[model samples]
Target: MAEATAHSIDQDDFTHVVKGIRYPPVVTEANLEAMLNFDIRDDDIVIAAYPKSGTNWMLEIVTKILSAGGRTDASSDDMVGKLEFQYPDEPRPHHVMLQECASPRVILTHLTPDTAPPGIAHPQNNVKVIVVMRNPKDTAVSYFHFLEKIKFQTGQKRFPSWDEFFQLFMSGKYNFGCYFDHILGWWQRRDDPHFLFLKYENMKQDLPKAVKTVAAFLQVKLDDASIETIAHACTFSSMKASLDNSRYRGRAVNARKGIVGDWKTMFTDEQSRLLDSKCKTKLEGTGLQFNFE
Candidate 1:
């Protein structure tokens, strides 16, 4: 593998990729203004993360923690279906879903800080927000596989090659803007009373404690037994199996192999060094850390 050249990043409005799933469009100042003016429920629970950063995993854990016995009734299928980020034209509007759901509605977004719905993530807002952090190297690797497993337009089955994808990823032109910038925006608010930050690697190291931490932030009281039930149900294997057998089978191809450090094999020495430099510079003095092991 060779060190790749930097590529131009595209900032298109709401592009569609991988089976009609829509990535939110470029967040112009006007767009952010609109979101700020929008109405949001006070009891809203927002989950934010870059793509392939254990978003779905966190969703399952948070959902199970809230629902006794680690499960909710079938009536919640509409709410459950709306948990992942959808295209701008998704049949149901995110705001509408929030309005329709019962109090303490849970919604997810892959948007950056500035672009976040104003009522949801404002510095003064006390809305509960869970932001999952992960090593961008691993995230990039997982996201690449996701793009491939998701059929592309023009009838192509796979995406641009790994080297090509890596360059585009480094340029911050791929999905959720620059990965570093997105995290930094949220990191600034870690001290906010309503925000909770969890590391992906730390969760892998100790799932029980991780689940408990999430529960505490959400103020969901669970005894030792309930915590254990949720931890078991949210295990990567259990969640993946559940998705496979459910209505989300093909739609969830990108949710496979919830492991860390795939970048070790996937990244060329040059690419690894480049990512390390970028991560180090962006994360310096921010006190955020990731375990690539």
Candidate 2:
């Protein structure tokens, strides 16, 4: 297990982590205006989730659905091209790319409530938003491993242990902004006709059902056979293997450990308790709970 440091750090240092990859402490009025003014069609769909919360998995599922039983003859690379990130400068740009694509766009984003594009929050907008969530313990563990690999590949020597990483995560000092604020914002709006909430563990436990649920939300029709094919194709093992040897090649780090509950091996009892306490406090009355144990 990783140990937390007793060494004290200032708020500025902590806030720096939250701003990582996002750059610019604030999104700025100009940026928000640009995003809100952008054209959004009625047929568009957005996949919104926190970092390391199965956003890619949901992207794969939506791509497969749009492909009509995964027989569109497009490679995973082609599918990746279709499912783009909305936040370009941020850690994940899939959501931005999706916005630029043609009709029936499936964009992914990690923006918190405050940072969510103005187009998404507009009542007149017809696009559907699907939000996915994972247990914070698991999300923290996965995020730490992801950052470690990033540090290694980028030649950065400073890597925090799992416990240290958890503290930062709890403090709302990770990329894509605060986790509590992000999920809670979406959770509160989950009852909207255009919003759907999906859990990572539930998707991993039964992907076909999850895929079908998403398809239904998008009003996309998929036959039983097509559903099975997508379910099989989106499995963590299949995606990991496919991504491992794709044209993108050597860029598939952290894609292999896409299983649910992997955090069990990475978090200690104390760390789990700390995370659970934070979750309980932040998530209260939201009707959103996690199976950390």
Candidate 3:
């Protein structure tokens, strides 16, 4: 299988069309070969999360922890580049740019269960994986805003309204198929010594504890002061402010709103109920429940 073709849309219709180049429903044969057969380092870690579910937040935290004793040159763009997408097989020139550095690589991927690269599931060395889960309602709201910004920048207007976007999300027509499936697939593997499941809500509720949890899992140690600094830096407010004049320099496109439960302000009661119902119906018996209320 090859990468999924980019869906083209007129400026007027961009609101309804999904942006970004889609990959094949399954991993391409060549990409799968490269990933499964590649020699992975024991210290490497993978940060997996659904879109708009604090993936970048976790990446920033992990990067800070990993780069603590290093220089002050760590920037958001560097983090993004080092944290590669495990699937899709596209040769990321940016990754090549970052690979020249001596830092340990941390990969970020959104590949669903069936589509994830085999190496992530079965590492040659003792690699660790961290999967983050967020409430689907908030994810939907954040994703809709993200798509709107993408449409504006790409000069495409295919984005659907909040209502329509909610429907598409609930229907599993968006990327990564159903949200519940993505969460459960990784959740089931939480017991694997290498797998750690981190909930966005838990992180938000207690960031320091979350940081310690992650550090312990990755065998990365930090003193109390270092952990406090990292926890403070990873807060939504701190991240949002950092994007104001940070090195990433794409605030308008990437880091618009970083608060949790923004969906409550964006979605109506009816829409909320509908989404709640869909999540409950589809997510039953998965041993995972999202706080959509």
Candidate 4:
């Protein structure tokens, strides 16, 4: 195996590759090792999404639905849940911290299926998984803007220009690896009863219906009134306001615009065609399709 590269956000920010997959510097070799052995409980609900794909929005909706509008302490961070970073005041890694949490934990991760907890990979584990995916074009555009935001905050160019980012993203050289690989890894397991596949576009189209689907998947019953309330609270504006006042103290949630086809404004015609052709080839015969608009 290649040596893991160490990077600091205060210094130069760079990604490292482990087992041929790229990840942020926070996701160290030790963390990846622990993640493989991480134990998942029966009632745990794991929300898996590629970065820039409505992860926090789904997290809010699911937690609210699970708590029946009551307060929930379920923590949702892409890296923390995957043991990529240790939380403050928490002595152990996140995977270890999860073991001490109460039952029916709402776990969030951006890890691919193979790298996620082994328990969720099996069909009979009783762990419910909610995988959220977005069209690659929009995802790429959003992710590029997100990186730029990070660069601005860190006062350093953490990533390349849009033209260079497009090439790196297409080659799967960016953090968390390729978008297509992550989507397909979980997409192949969509038939498992405990697994539920969601599209960000679909959720934006009718959030109340999406809430109902998630509730049903978790076996949590909710009336139309409750669904509407959760949907309203999960809207982009509402959630952004809540996050703005949140004590979590992480970087921005990067939900800018939150609309589909934003890629049209950013991507050149050839770039669009390139992504379209790549998606067409990767997703062919999988019966999975995405709506650009």
Off by over 4 Å in 1: 1-34, 69-90, 123-126, 152-158, 245-251
**lDDT for each residue of candidate 3 in 1-293, tens digit (9 for 90 to 100):** 22221242122222222223233222233443344344445666788887778777888888887777453356655664322332224455333333454446677777554556576765545688889999888888888888776555455535567766676677665655567767777787866788888888788888999988888777777898998998998887778766555543233355766656788888898887887787778777777776544
lDDT of 3: 0.65
The lDDT-based order of candidates, best leading, equals 4, 1, 2, 3
lDDT of candidate 2? 0.66
lDDT tens digits, residue span 1-293, model 2: 11223234223322233223231123333443355455567776777888788877787788778788433444445543312222224453343445556666665556655555666654345688889999887888888887776565445555666666677677765556568877887888876888889999888778889989988877778888888898999998788876666543223664957776788898888877877788888888878887654
| Pairs that collide, model 4 | none
lDDT (10s digit) by residue, model 1, range 1-293: 11222452332323433221224332233333456565666666678888888777787787777786333442222353433333334565445445566755667777776767766567345478889988999999998888676544223533468898898778765656678888888988888888899989999889999999988887777899988888988888777766655554233574577888788878999999999999889888999988998
The TM-score leader among the candidates is 4
TM-score of 2: 0.80
Better of 1 and 2 by TM-score: 1
Please report the TM-score between candidate 3 and the true structure.
Answer: 0.79
Q: Which residue pairs clash within candidate 2?
A: 84-94, 84-95, 84-98, 85-93, 85-94, 85-95, 85-96, 86-95, 86-96
lDDT of 1 at 26: 28
Per-model TM-score on C-alpha atoms: 0.83, 0.80, 0.79, 0.88
Candidate 4 accuracy as lDDT: 0.77
Clashes of each: 0, 9, 12, 0
**Worst 10-residue lDDT window, candidate 3:** 9-18
RMSD values, in order shown? 5.4, 5.3, 5.2, 3.8
